[model samples]
Target: MVEVTPPEGSQVVIEMWSDLGCPWCYVAKHRLRAAIAQRPDADRFKIVIRSFQLDPRAPRKPEKNEQAFIRAHGGTAAQVFQAERQMQAIAREEGLEFSLDRLHANTFDLHRVVRYANDDGRGFEFFSNVQDGFFAGALNPYVPDALEGVAEAVGLSGHRVREILASNEYADRVRADRAEGLELGATGVPFVVFDRRVAAPGAQKVPGYGRLLEHVAGPVPSERVS
Candidate 1:
């Protein structure tokens, strides 16, 4: 079990820049969660998700599998397949499932849902559910009804989701998040920034995050501090 509180001056805040269609980002999310859970003072830490779009050129519908989109965007299918296998192995270790057959759709609206979730104070849970919907079940986020279903499942109103999809609600927030990531020197997704003190870029391991957290929150002596 983890404590909701930690020693004074020991709180850590992490900002993760990620995209829904990015395989490594999904793995990174799981690793962060697992690492936090391992700490006795998990609740003292907060993980804020910052949006990034790996495939902004991706269509708004499911035209093909992710590989096809990547191929159309210039990468070879074999390359995508090889990367998928490696990522799937890592995801499995983190108790996450990946559906490589899923379509690669534009993530703009999906990110809007994330902002709304943040407004509702359920951003983290909504982000987790979106990851599961995309990687575990291949749900297409650009599909309005499908996205609404996901929002409803996470306790968000389907009507509100539909409204968001219908308009440009929270669109600026998504763009602002990406801008912040870029300003932080991120040229890619899965960039983890810890309290403006440390920045790690990639699908880092659980222990890697643990080390970062420890460094940020100070040493945990005898697990009592945590």
Candidate 2:
């Protein structure tokens, strides 16, 4: 269990730059939640996950397995295998079931769909799906049908998702998000900016987050100081 205190006059806003297909980002989200749970005034903080595509040029449909995808994306065969083991370990620790076999290497279409979801008052829907679909379900997020399925799973309109896929609206927003992500110094997925001051590059432990949040709120004052 953790202890919490009332929020100070200052509020904490977290700008999270992440890629939907990044396993590390999902783990980071879980760690962030743990930190929030420790704070009594968690409501004083607003967290938003922005988009940052790791593979901006990825095709709409990738033709590779998880191992090949990782290798093509800069990691070697051994490295990819090690990463898979690490991902499995982390998923287990987080109490999440991971389906790595079902994952596809592409994320462009998935990202485009998410942009449309934002406009339909379900901005969080696609984001939530990516978190689960990529990190847990290990589904090919770039496929149109897969993305549509994700939308349906999240209670969003499947028809709308299909419509977005057919149009250019969603793709434009994906471009915008990528631009903003770069401007915000998020060159990689799962980059986090906390309290507009502290920044973390990837998935960190709960204690690190706790310390950061505490700094944002400052120290609790004694009654005599008041």
The lDDT for every candidate, in the order shown, is 0.79, 0.69
Colliding residue pairs in candidate 1: none
Off by over 4 Å in 1: 1-11, 66-73, 221-226
**lDDT of model number 2:** 0.69
Q: In model 2, where do residues sit more than 4 Å from their true spots? A: 1-11, 67-78, 119-122, 138-140, 152-155, 218-226
Per-candidate clashes come to 0, 0
- TM for every model, in the order presented, reads 0.87, 0.77
TM-score, prediction 1: 0.87
lDDT minimum window of 10 residues, candidate 2: 1-10
True-vs-predicted CA distance for residue 213, candidate 1, Å:
0.5
The model with the greatest TM-score is: 1
For residues 1-226, what per-residue lDDT tens digits would candidate 2 score against the true structure? 1234335655667767777667788778878877877776776776766667786665555544454466457767677767778888887888876665654455666667766666665655468666776665566566568777878877788888888778765676678877876776766878887766767777889898788777767643344543
**Prediction RMSDs, each to the true structure:** 4.5, 5.4
Say what the RMSD of model 1 is: 4.5
